[model samples]
Structure formats: C-alpha cells, structure tokens
Target chain A: MPNYPKGERRRAEILEAAFDAFGTVGYRNASMVQIAADCGVSRAGLLHHFPTKESLLEAVLKQRDRIDNEQFFAGGTSDDGLDYLTRMVRLVEHNAAHPGIVSLFAVLSSEASDPGHPAHVYFQERYARSRSWLRRAFRDLEQRGMLRPHVQPDGLDVEFLSLLDGLQVQWLLQPDAVDMPARVRAFLSRVLTEVA
Target chain B: MPNYPKGERRRAEILEAAFDAFGTVGYRNASMVQIAADCGVSRAGLLHHFPTKESLLEAVLKQRDRIDNEQFFAGGTSDDGLDYLTRMVRLVEHNAAHPGIVSLFAVLSSEASDPGHPAHVYFQERYARSRSWLRRAFRDLEQRGMLRPHVQPDGLDVEFLSLLDGLQVQWLLQPDAVDMPARVRAFLSRVLTEVA
Candidate 1:
C-alpha cells in the first residue's frame, strides 16, 4: 500500500545486481550487459539509471558506506573506547555473515591503491575518515581515563586499524580458522583496560 | 663476461619485464604484448619462454618469494626471537625502497581472495608458510624465556602476522605517514623481553 517511486525501486534493483557482478568476478571482468541481465532489465534500461560502469561502482560504494554507517555508528551510544570496541566486534560479526560484500570491499580497496584507479580517492578518504573516527574514540576514552597510561591515541588508532584490516583478510582467506570477533576482542583487551 | 646459457639470460630478461608490467598495472590488465615490448622481443618469442600469462605470474610470485627469503632469512642468524624480529624490521626497511612490488602484492593478494582467482592457491600457501615460519621463531623465543609468560607462541604468531600484514597495507596506502620498520620493532619490544 505504501507508495514508492518505481524508478527509485528499479535503481536499487540495478545496484543490487551491479554489486553482485562486481563482487563476484570483479570490475574488469564484470560486464554491463551481464549486470543488466541479472537485474532482469535490458542494457539500456540499466544505463538509464547508471550511465557508465564507473558511475555505478561509485553509487554502489556510497550505498555500502551509508549502510555500514547506519548499522554500526548510528545508535549514538558509543561514548568511549570500550563502546567503540564493542561496536567493532559487532561489525566483524556482521561481516562474517556477508562475505560477498566484504570481498568486494577488499578487492576494490586493494585495486584502488593505484593512483590512477577510479576509486583511489574514495578509498584514501575512507581510510582517513576511519582513522579519524578511531582517533576520536581513543581520545574520548583517554579523557575518561580508560586507556593505559602509556598508550598514545594516535598511534593506537593506526595500529588498531591495521589489526582490523589484517584480521579481516585472514578471516576471509580461512573462515574456519579465524574467529574475527574474538581476535578483535583480544586486541582490545591487550591495549585498553577498563576503569574500575 | 661470465659464461651463461643464452636461453637462461633471455628468460631472466623476460621475467624482469614481466615483473615490471605485472607490478605496475596488475595481472589482469597487463598484456603479454606489452611485456614483450618492454623486453624488446616479439610476442611469440616471449610466449616461447612462458607459455601463458598465468605461468608468467606464477614465476613472478616465485621470484618475489625467492628475493624476500634471501634478503630476510638467508643469513640464518635469526637464532632467537630477537634476531628474527630484527630481520623483520630490516625487511620492512628494504621494502621501503621498492614500493612497486609491495603494491603488486597488496593488489594480487586481495584479488586472490576469490576461490576462482588464479593466484588464490598461491597466496593461501604463502600465508601458511609465513605463519609457520613465524610460529617457529616464536616457539624458539618461548623456549628461550623471551616471550611474556602469558603469551603463547601460536597466538603470538597469529597476532604478529596480522600486524605485519596490516602495517604493510597502511604503509602502501600512505608511505610518508608510516614508519614501517619502527612499527614492527615497537610491536616486537612490547611482546618480547630480553633475557638478562
């Protein structure tokens, strides 16, 4: 009974198919015709929403960021480092449930290391933003006297981000061998101590 | 000049060009014709040495592994954990001088996460072998009473490998912002204490 724009609905459907195609065989291997077919639309129909493959990829990445931000940070309850750590654990747990998206992210981000890559700027800013967020969380915890006295928030932020990424790659490669959430928790415990 | 097989010399030249091509644009984007052009050979001549692109990639990876093992572990002077840690720092320092290979590794390894990726098996075994190597080093340190009493070699191995990989990605993304060797050294000192 709810009214939604049919064009908008179709755009979402096209993006979904695009995500699947790009994530499975990767960008270079994915074809517009194939993605259109997957979406049950003609190639021109898909192009009406996304003029080019690059534009579609950008839209997909933006959508991914929006969904992640909503799911992980929108609760507004992360008052300190401990809360942030908890959210990270939850995010990893979430990632385990969705390997395809994670694979897409890993592959795209890695590919974007090339300065000429289409998503290079996007990924660069993404890492910078993530680092800043972690830095602020650590800063808040330090203000509240939760961090170990020797821990510098900036350095810890960098190290924590590295561990998060590194652990994800390992988990993706050998899912049965790694418990990502547990690893994150162990890292958190090693670096941060809760105030009594 | 020292006597060398003409075929062996030509093969080496071809591999050097292959490395340059693959490391610059990645595996999928690099063409045999471009690689042959770089080597100043005909495409048919290049194919004579490496029957396929996949074979060339495999050879490039193997060559990379050989150089890394030689530079980092050939001396066999890593008698204890501290020695092994020092070697790791040195390797990172060496890596700073060669960003191309590092970028290639970051891209290919991420791409290889897909089971269908040609290099997937190669990367999986590489990680396994690296983990085993680190485990032995940690185990040796444990035997020498170098590791913190609470730290188990197996867990430390996983953590160290994670940190190593994580740091590499960060360094590749923002080389000017990270001191890779210093980060490795700091992590080492935090986990292992010198026996007095």
Candidate 2:
C-alpha cells in the first residue's frame, strides 16, 4: 500500500533509536554515532534517513508530542475537568519514569521560545493550543457548577494553567518530592469542593 | 572605607549592565562586547574584572538571589509561612516587569540540574536549601493551626514549591494572559481558607 515501505520502516527505526539515545544521554550529549550504534546501523545510514542532529532532535520532539497527546488525552472522557487532573498525574508519573524525556523538555522549552531555535515554532504552537484547550475546559467546569461562584470567570483559567505549568518545572527539578499529578488532584478536588 | 572605590563601582556597573543585557538578549546571545558597550567600557575592560562570560552570568544570578532575599524576606519575615505568599507575589510581579530575568532564570534553572552544566551544583544546592526552608515554614503554619489538623505535614511544602515553580513557566509563556501575582494570591487564598 506504500511506496518505499522499507524506507519508511527504516526511518521509523532510526528515529526510535535516536529517541532512546537522546532520552538517556540528553540532546547536547547524544551523538549520531551513539544513535547509529544503538540502532545497529551505519552512521551514514542514520544520516541518510535523518540528515542532521537538529533534524533528528526535532523528529524526537514531534514523536513525543503525538505520544504524549495519546497517552494523556486519549480522546474521550471529557465530562468535567477532573480527568485533566488525573491525566496530569499520569503525565507526571510517566515523566518520572522517563526522566530523560523530562530533561529534554526542560532543556528545550526555554530555548524553543527564541524564535530561531529549532523547536521554536513547535513549542509556541503547542503552548498556545494547550492553553486554549485548558481554558476551555475550565470554562466548562465553571458552567457546570464545578467551580466556586466566587472564582472569577475571567481569571479562573489563568490560575489553573499557571498551576499546571508551575508544577511541571518543580517535578522536573525534583521528581522524588513533587508528585505533580497528586498536587493537581488536590487543587482540583478543592476546586470542586468550593463550587456553588 | 573600602579599597578600589572606582574599580568596585565599575565592576558593579558592569554587572548591572550585563544583567540587563543577559535579561534582554539571553545568556547565549548577549555578548561581552555589547555588555561592555552598554556599560560604556571597552570589551577588554569588561573582561578585566570578570574573566569569562560564565563568571559574569554567575554574578548576575547571585545578584538576583541577593535582591530576591532583600525584597521578598526583608527583615526575615519568613518567620511565618503565610507571609511568604505575599513575598512570592511580589517576586512574581518583579519578574513580570523584567521578562528577560525571568527567561534567564528559567533558562539556567533548566540547565542547572545537569551535573556537568556550569550552574548545576548551584541549582541543586538552591533546591535543597529552598525545600528545607519551605518545609519548616509549612511546619510552622501547621504548628500555628494555620493549616487544617489533617493536612499532610511534609507534602504541603512540595506542593507549595511546585505551585511557585509551575506558575513561573506559565507566566513566561503567556505573559499577557497570566496575572501571576493575582493567580498566586488566589491560590493562597484558597489554601488558607480550605486547608490552612
């Protein structure tokens, strides 16, 4: 059904190897040689599939995004924002397990905002979309009497999103101490408890 | 009373200029030449006091620690943990005014965890010290009955710290959308009324 079937599989294989390499060793330290060795392929073959380190890094980040969305959102169960908290905890748990991925996101997100950085546009778009979705979810919670009447509708979204972003930084810093999912759960539980 | 009056002044001036430069241009992009120009000094003169860019960056971060301590906990108000929220808001507001400084810290902090990174040890120590201080403060709040009787004693510190760190990431990403101080204030208000 596909032209260049072997090529596609080869590309996917190389990308997987690179992901593992970068996740463990980090973006700066992970090299083409290491990736090729991990894949049991020649260095030239690895480059033939993905020509440059930047290209490989971008591929890994892109793959991560799709995987992350699938893992967290999973496309259903959007009755209230409670799922968001549970999903957030699951995300943190995943990050804790794959500390390398956490490290990659932390190292790159800041530079990604630079406009010229490789992942600049990707990070910006991801952030914008994520923020919009989060705000919409909070608004739904408010409408469904899931939030306090005193919670300013105009400002509620920002509070939720800020707490979410803030906790990620902390979790990345000390995964052993900061259970991101649990903290979100507590805050969300409080939100529900305070609702009108 | 101090020796090298002019030298001290020049060094201070350079650090200030460099701070502004790094904040605006980022650590990687802001060059010593531009920093020298910003301070009305020759590039070599700028280097005479601080030999390397890394050293200058370290000085800037150290300056931030000094300023943060002075403004946030002046007269050692951290004696009670509740007041820390007010200081935290103040810190957030200060950062909003200087987005570059926000970027600087966010950028360095991300790198600060990598053992081989220049600022790694500094950040690691900072996290340890900060966690200890916050844990004691939360414990004090519990002792004063500022928190509910059943509130988990040790975990609140991690939660509070996570909130602080997580909020900053959101603030930087969508500065227009996030009223950091107000968001933090709301979180504190909720925590005080509900848990405290």
Candidate 3:
C-alpha cells in the first residue's frame, strides 16, 4: 500500500507553506510554484495534494477555523452568554500573539468580497454562521437582561463581528496603537451590563 | 499646449478604469494591460500617465481620499463633536450607495497590512491620521460632557474606526443584511450621550 502517513505529512507541510504565503503576499500574489518550492515539493506534487490554489486556500482556511473553534470552545461550547463573550476576548488576545493568523483572515475575507472570487461564497456563508452564533450569545444575554437598553438586537451581531474583523486590520497595520483585546472588551462593556 | 485638456481627460478615464478593476479583483490580481484596454488606451499610453502600477494605485487612493474628505467636510471641518459624528453617519450612508468605494477600501486596507505591500505606509499613516481626527472628536464630546461614563478614552478612536472598517466587509458580502449607516449611528449612540 501507499505510504498514507507520509502523504498526510506532506499535505500538512504544503498547507503550512501556503498559509504563510497567502498571509504575507495575499492569495492573488502568492504563487503555487513558489509555495511548492518553499515546502520542498515539486509543482506536480503540490498539485497532487491541493489540486489547485483555491483548494489549497480552502484547506488553509478550514485549518484556521478548526484551530479557532478549538480555542474558543475549549470547554465544549458554553451556553452562558457572558462566558461566550469572555472566550471571545481571550480569542482576540490569542490572535494578537499570532499576526499571521490575523493577516490571513483579514486578507482573504476582504479579497473574497468580490463576487467573482473563488472564496466569495465561503466568506458569505462564514459570516452568516458567525452572526448566527453571535445571535445565540446575544439572545442569552437578552434573556438574562444583561444587554444594555441602548444596544439594539437587530444589528448587534453584524456590529460585533465587524468590530472584531475590523480590529484585526488595524492591529495588523499598527499593533502598538491597537490593543485588540482591550478594544473588544471595551465594546462588550458598552453593550452588556455585566462583562463577566 | 499639446492638448493638455485631452491628456487630463485621458488620465481621469484611466483612473476610473483602474479604480473599478482594483475594487473588483483587488490590486494583486488586476492586470495593468486589462485596465488599459478597459479605458480604450494602448498599454504604452496608459504607462505614460501612470508610469507604474504602484503609481496608479497611489493616484486612485488619493482620489478616493479627496472625494471622502470633500463629502465629510463639505461644511469646512466641523469642530462640533456631534456634528462630526452626524457627518460620519452621512458618509456611511453615502458609501452604501457606492459599493465600489467600500470594496476598494476594504480590499486594499487589509491587503496593505503586509509590511512589504506598496501601500503599507499609506494605510498606516492614513489610520493614524484617522485616529487623530477621531481623537479630536472624542475630546470635543468629553469637553461637552456628552461622553458616556463607561466609555474609556484610551482606545475609543481605534474601536470606532475598527467598527466602521469592519462593517464594510460584511455589508459588501451581504448588503441586505447590513445597514452600514444605521450600525454606525447605533455605535455612536452608545459612546455619545447624544448622537445628534
């Protein structure tokens, strides 16, 4: 039989190379051939693993999400709204330590806004899913009467997600000027009566 | 006078074409030759006006800034904190009608986060200037005793700008789901006692 373990290892290596390349130069500018060279694989071998740049991008994005979900839901998905938000702040703090992860999401999500982009549908659905999750958290807060009177439930999901996404770009550009966790906590404080 | 007016017209046409391409496909994927063709100019002719892709990007960015400033400061730079925020909401309203501008900023700003990107310094300084301007507004509100008690002064500028920048990506992805101006107004209401 073929060496399954070796094949998986090689695939992971290619993904690591692509993740870094996409984060650094962006998806459009990152070349598959260069990514192959970076990972000590032939172009054909890289294609064998990824099939295409879009496929490679998809794999990288999925990997990022897996890591993020693991970190954010380390306790296996807390239903407590305050606990959820506390986890979000910790996640943002985690992101601050890893600029590469922040850069990848910022670059890809913005690039994917073009209707013709390969990842266009992916990001659209991703944001929808994110909003739904946040909606649950906000609903929990509302039931507990923790949501501030001024905070409208209608657009809070979009606003909170936007705040998180937008903070990444600013933090990437000027890390010294932006404290991502602090900003996120500040926003949470304004929206919720008890931040936890 | 070698047809100076005609040359200026040609330059404007090129700028418009480049703007659309950059917004749609982003800077890295947009082909210079395609942009020239879109504007009905020869590649060499396009180069005569903008010697390089980076130069064209700079011109397009400057034009965007000029338009934004004109729209935001139509009243000659309002020092009134509430008036400034009202103008900002109006600007977000203006942006909703023009998706191209929003796309361009969202795509470029995130892409420009890479330190090696040509517009890296431009966006870095732009955000700095933005934060400084926001700082002035928050300071004015503080002086007027209109700032909320919970609003921390340290990173409000970054948080507000992050919200605006972050909202654009979501709006561009799902326009019907995001009311950019309303979200901006809502966030402002939380920070300021009176949003005007």
Candidate 4:
C-alpha cells in the first residue's frame, strides 16, 4: 500500500468541509470558523492546513479539478473525439448526482468574473485550459471528418462549453424540469451528425 | 418641459453609481461607502434612498430589466419570432458595450443560487419570466411555420437563454477573443433554419 501522510489526510478533510460550506452558503458568506467546525478541527488546526481563506478556496477548487479529471478524463487519451464527448456526457451524468458541487462551481465561476474576486485568476486559467483542450479535441475530430461539414470545430468549442455551463445553471434552478444529461446528449448527437 | 424631481434624479444617480461600483467589484466585495462616495453622498445619505445592500441590489436589477426591456423588446409585439430573436441579438450587441454591467449580472445570478442569498428569489423570478417570454415567442414562430420542423420551439427556449448567458460569461472573461453577438446570431440562424 502507498504511504499516506497524516497531514495530507487532514488537508483533504479540511478541503471537503470547505467545499460543503462554500457550496451551501457561497464563498463570501462562508466563514473559516464554520468550515473548521464542520471538519471537527480547531480553528488553529484548520489554519495550519490553510493560512488564508483564499488559499483554502484555491485548494478546494484544485481538489475538485483533480477529482473531475480522474473521473472524467481517465480514458480520454483515445483518438476518437466522439468518444471524448461521450466521456463528457458521463461527466454531466456524474454532475447530476452531485448537485452541491455543481452549484458551487456555477456560483464561483460567475463570482470570479470580478477582477478582484479571489477566484478570478483561478477561473481565468481554468477557462483558458478548458477552451484550449476542447479546441484541440474538436480539431482532431474535424481532421477525421467526424464534425459536420459546415461546423467550424474551433468555433463550436465555445458554444459547447457554454451549453454545458448554462445547462447546469438551469438544472440547478429547476432540477425536475431540466433533464440536463438528456438535453446535452441530444444536442451533442445532433451536432456530431456526419454530413453527407 | 418635462419635470425632473431632485429626489428622483438623486435616486437615479445613486443607482448608476451603485451599478458601476457593483459591476467593478462584484456584489459581495462592493462597499456601500464606496458607492455613496462615487455618487457624492454620505453612507447614511445613500441609505436614505435605499435602505440596505440587498434592497439596492434589487433596485439595480430592476433598473437593468427596465433598460433591457425598453431596448430589446420595444417593438417585439409583432407575430414574428425571428424579429424577437433579432432584438435579442441587438441586446447582446448592446451588452458588449457595457462589460461592467454584464459582469455584475453574471456574478450575482450565480451567487443567487443559494436559497438564502438575498437575490435568490429575484433571480428565480427573473429566469421564469424570461423563459416564459421566450417560450411564448417561440410557440408563435412555430405556429407561423417559421421554425425548422425538427426544432421543438418550446424546448429551444432554455437552450437559447443558456447560450445567451453562457456566452456572456465567456465574453466577459475574454472580451477581445469571444464574438458573442456573431456567435449567437449564427447559432440562432442554424436552429431557425427552415426544413426542406
């Protein structure tokens, strides 16, 4: 078995609690004391793990990305872009099972638009990475003639991401009314149809 | 000559300054004192016009709606759904000129997802109204045989709004990189294509 450091474990515990608090009450309203209480750690103990709220939030967002990457991008090394999109659908399906995390992300991303917001730089980098990845994936699909003839693969990347983000917001607002996974699947299938 | 009450003028000035401050710093980080200073008023003086942060936010949001409605839906009472969409494009084009307001709105709407968030109810009602308006407009287009046969007019409403909002976020993040209005127009054109 791989060695597990006690400090690392404590850090993980703090992050989980932070995510819960931030997701439920929002970043601005969530206090560090509350997060520490949630994690069963003294305020000083939590501070040892993360000295600042911004640092704690950054760690939480990174942890989220690591989990998402592991869960959704594990087999994305395959050359098939369609398969990659299928993985994206799976990720959305997974998101449906975890509404709190989705809400946290949606809320943070929007809040991060303000240049002074703590997550603003983090989100900027995140979007840059995501957009470039999708652009590369779509370009690969185009090379194989999988994308529709009229579709500019790179241009569609922005729209695809937008739909994903937008759908999540709608689903969060009205879970029962918005069947997010179904809508995404249908939309993707239509967009990916091979043109004669 | 039209009469302009001093209180009404001051209220409008406060709102404009508030909108600017909130847009720059985001709702959470923006200070009432700064907004009052921007409007050449004291904190208590500003509070005389709007009592609380939440109340001020609500008023700013309402003012945004009034401006948007006046600008985009001014002449949208006709039977053609395409015309309404054209108006939406115009609104987006207009939004491009005001990145601060767009950023403020995007951030706040996401922040409002938490049930207890002050603007939560406001966003909920705003979304419901927007969706319903689009649904009605799309239904009319379908009745007029304008929508593509494969297009479910009612269903497209959410996706349409999603694209609008999603694109706005992306545009705000990379103002020079994302051509939101053009992308929206292209997407709408594709969706509204008449089936042969």
**Fnat of all models, as shown:** 0.37, 0.33, 0.90, 0.46
Off by over 4 Å in 2: A1-6, A13-58, A73-79, A115-118, A148-156, A194-196, B1-6, B13-47, B52-54, B75-78, B148-153, B194-196
Q: Rank by lDDT, highest first.
A: 3, 4, 1, 2
Model 1 Cα shift for residue A110 (angstroms)? 1.1
lDDT of each: 0.76, 0.68, 0.90, 0.77
What TM-score number comes out for model 1?
0.90
Model 4, residue B190: what's the lDDT?
54
* Candidate scoring better on DockQ of 1 and 3: 3
Residue B77 of model 4, lDDT score:
65
Tens-place lDDT per residue, model 2, A127-175, is 6677677677777777777775445555555566555555555666566
Candidate 1 deviation (Cα RMSD): 2.9
Q: Which tens-of-lDDT digit does each residue in A95-143 have in candidate 3?
A: 8999999999999999888888888899999999989988999999998
lDDT of 2 by residue, B156-196 (tens): 56666656665556666656666767766666655554321
Top model number, lDDT? 3
Indicate the residue-level lDDT of A172 in model 1: 70
Candidate 4 C-alpha lDDT tens digits along B1-196: 1366988888888999988876665576678888998889888889999999988998999888888888876764665667777788889899999887687777777766777778777877777888887888778777777765555554577787787778877887777667888778666655666421
How high is the DockQ of candidate 1?
Answer: 0.50
lDDT of 3 by residue, B22-113 (tens): 89878887999999999999999999999999999999999999999989888687588788878888999999999999999999999899
The superposed Cα distance between candidate 4 and the true structure at residue B57, in angstroms, equals 1.9
Poorly placed runs, candidate 1 (over 4 Å): A1-5, A77-79, A149-154, B1-6, B77-79, B149-154
Cα lDDT, model 2, residue A44:
87
